[model samples]
Target: MKKKDLLKLPSVSEVLLEINDNKYHNDKYIKYIIKDEIAAFRSQAKQGSLQLDRNQIIQSILLKITKLSTASIKPVINATGIILHTGLGRAPVGKKIISKVSKRLSGYVNLELNLETGKRGQRQEHISALISSITGAEDAMVVNNNAAAVLLSLNELAEGKDVIVSRGQLVEIGGSFRIPDMITKSGCKLVEVGTTNRTHISDYEKAISSNTGLILWVHTSNYIISGFTKQVKIDELVELGRKKRIPVMSDLGCGEILDLSNKGIPTNMIVHDVIKSGSSITTFSGDKLLGGPQCGIIAGKRSLIKRIKVNPIARTVRSDKWTISLLEETLRSLRMDSINDNLTLSLMVTTRKELEKRANKLLSVIPTKLRSNHNISIQETFVEAGSGTLPGATFDSIAFKISSKKYTPAKLSDKFRNAQNPVVGYIKGNNYYIDFKSIISSQEKLLLSSIVEVLG
Candidate 1:
C-alpha cells in the first residue's frame, strides 16, 4: 500500500498509447475508462490484493473497454424451448412480416401524413382500424406495452377515484410490476374485494360507491388458483357495471386474438369475445399471445377510447411508426387465417411429431467424433408457453440430452453459451438439455455447428 507501489500503475496517457485500435479513438471516453481502472487498481493495492504487473493492468483495462464497446443485445438461439421466453424476447415476428415492414419503413411511407389531405395525421391510424376489425371493438389504440395501456386507461377513467379489483387477480408480472402499484401510479386508489382464493360478484357490489371511478377485472395470466377458488367473470362484471352505471375495465394480460384450442393450446377470451362481453375498456399485451411486436392494445367502446387518446400520457406511451407497421401486418396475417406465417403461433402449434423429426435430424448430423466423445441422445421433455401466457400448460417437446465424463453439465452449458453464436440450454440432474421446441428450422445448421465445435 505504499505510494511507490501505486506509482507503478500505468498512467492514462500510457494506456491510451497502447490502445492502437482506431475504433477506440474516442480519447475522452478512453481516458474516463482508464481513470476508472486506475482507481480500482489503487483500491486493490490498499486492500493488499493488487497485482503489480503493469502489462496485466493495461490488458485488463483493454478488456473492459472492449466489453463496454460491444453491443449486449445481439440475438442468441433459444435452446431451452420455453416458447415466448421473456428473456429471449417474448414473441418472434415472422420473416415475411419483417420483410414487408422493412420495405415500407426502411424509407418512409405515410407514418403520420394524410397523403390525400396533404396534412399531418395520427400514427395510431395505421393500426387502429386493423385492431378494431380483428377484435370487434368499436375502436382501438396502441401503446408502448400492456402496463402503459393499463396505466393510461386507469389514469383517464378513474383518476382520483377508487378502482375495485379482486384480490385473487391482483398478480405481479415480470420485473415485479404489480397491479396495486400500477393503480396507485395512475392516480387511483386500489380497492381490494373478496378473499385471495374467492371473489364473488357480491364482493364487487358491496365495494362500489359514489367514489368508484372504475371496476377493474384483472386476468391472472401468470398464475392460477384452483380448488375452492371463486372469481367474477367478465360478463358478470359487465352486467354489474351497467346496472351501477360505472365503467368496467378488464386487463387481459396476454391477449388472444385467435382461438388456439384447435392447436392443442388452451383457449382464453379472444379480444373480440372480451369486447362482446360488454366491457367498457380492455387492455392486453401485443407480444404475448397475439404474436406481434411489443406493444399494448387497448380496445373497447369508441367513446372511452376517444377519451384515452386525448390524455397527455397517451402521447408519452404511444407506439411509434415501426410498431404500428409491424402490428398492422401481424393483424393482417391473422385476418387472412395465415397462422403459419405468424412465428409465435407457428412455434406454439408445432406438433410433437415435427419436433421429433427436428430432433432426429440434429442427432443424425452430429459428427461421429463428437458422438464417440459424448453421450448424446434424444429425450422427451416439456416446455411452457412462457411470459405468463398459458400458466400450468406445458407443450410436449424433444431435446438433445448431452452428458460427458470429461465435462460437467455446468461446464458443457457454459461452453455452449459462450460460443461464437451462443446456445442456451438448461442443466437438469447431471445432464445438459437443449430443447428443440423453440429452435426455428433456420437455426438448425448453427445449432449443429455449435454442438460439434463444443464437443469435438
Candidate 2:
C-alpha cells in the first residue's frame, strides 16, 4: 500500500461496525485491539513496509482481535519432569473436580451454611473432617497457602512474644519466602537457636525464656545440608514444648499423607506421623506432595486449631468455596486408594519402565524426515519432584533427545515454548530433552504434534 492510500484506511468505527456484528468478537475490548492494529499498520504504511491490501488488513485485524479476546492464558504441556513445577501452575489438578466443583464456581454453595438448620456454619467444616482423618489430627483448617498457615499460626499464638526456632531450620523455599521473614511478619520475635550446621534440642531448651510463646519447628524439605548436620526431631521438640507449657508448631512445607518411600519415591514425612509427634499445630502445603489444590493446611490439637481459626488473619487468608470443594474431593480420593489416578502422584511415582515405554511410543511416531534432520534418541534422564518437595531426591526417567543440524538446542527450546500451548523441556550440551516422567500418556500426541509443528 502507498503512503497516500494510508489516509483512506478505514476508521476505528468502520472496523468495529464490520466485526462487532459478529457474535464471537463483540466484546468491549475489541476496539482497543482494532485501534492498536490500525496504528501499527499506519506506522508500517508510512515506513513503506505495508504489503497487504485493505481486505488483508481487515482479515488480519479480525484474527488478532478474535485471538486477543478468546485466548488469555494458554495451558502448556509439562515435559520438564518437575512434577510440581511451579511455573506451570505447580501441581496439575485433575479434571475430576470439574464436575464436582462446577456448581460451586457458577452458583451458590453451602460454603458456610448448615443445611440441616439453615443457620451459619464454618467453611473449615468442609475439609476439616477429611484432613483430620488423613493426618490423625484432632482438628484442621486451611488457608490460601502454606505460608499463610504459618503466618496465621504465628500471628495468633506467638505475636507479641518469642518463637524459638532452630537456626538450621530457618530456611527459604521457592519464591524467596524465608521462615525468619514469616516469623517477623507475624509480630513474633524470632529467637534463633543453635548453628546452621548443627541445631540440638538443647538449643531450644536454652532459647526458652519467660516470654517464649511457641516452639516453631521447620522442615528443610526444599534443600538439604550434608556432612555433619543435626536438627532436633519433631517429637523431641514437642516434648520440650509440653514441658515448657508452650505449643510446638511444625511447618512441614510439603505435607504427604502416603509414605511415598514405600512406593519408591523418597519423601520426608508421613503427614500423620508428623501430627502424631504431638506438635500442637502442624502446617503444610496442599499442592506439593499431597497432590491437592493450592492451599495451606493447619491440623493438630483441636484447641490450637480452634484458636488459629478465630484469628482475624484467618479471614483474609482463607480458602474460597472452589478450593474447599476441590480439596474435599482430593482428600476423599486419597482415602479411596485411587490416588494414582491423580496427575501429581502418578507423575511422581511413574516407573522408569513406564517412561521408557512412553519414549518408545513417541519415537515410533516421529516422521522419517523430521527424525533424520534432528538426531533423535532415547536417553536416561533424572526427574525431580519440584516446588520444594523431596529435595535432592531424583527418580529415573526416559527422555527424547533432539539435536538438530538446522537449529541449536536453545533455539529449538525457544521455538517449542513459542507454540500455541507451550511445551517445556531442558537443554543439555547441544541437545534438547523432554523428560517423560511428568508427561501424561494422553499428552503424547499433543507433544508429537507440537514437535512436528516446530521442527518439521
Q: lDDT value for candidate 1?
A: 0.90
lDDT of 2 by residue, 374-447 (tens): 98889998878888888898989999899899999999899999876579999888789988888877778889
lDDT, candidate 1, 148-212, per-residue tens: 99999999999999999999989999899999999999999999999999999999999999999
Q: Whose TM-score is greatest here? A: 1
**Candidate topping lDDT:** 1
TM-score for candidate 1, residues paired by index? 0.94
Worst 10 residues of 1 by lDDT: 20-29
Clashes of each: 0, 0
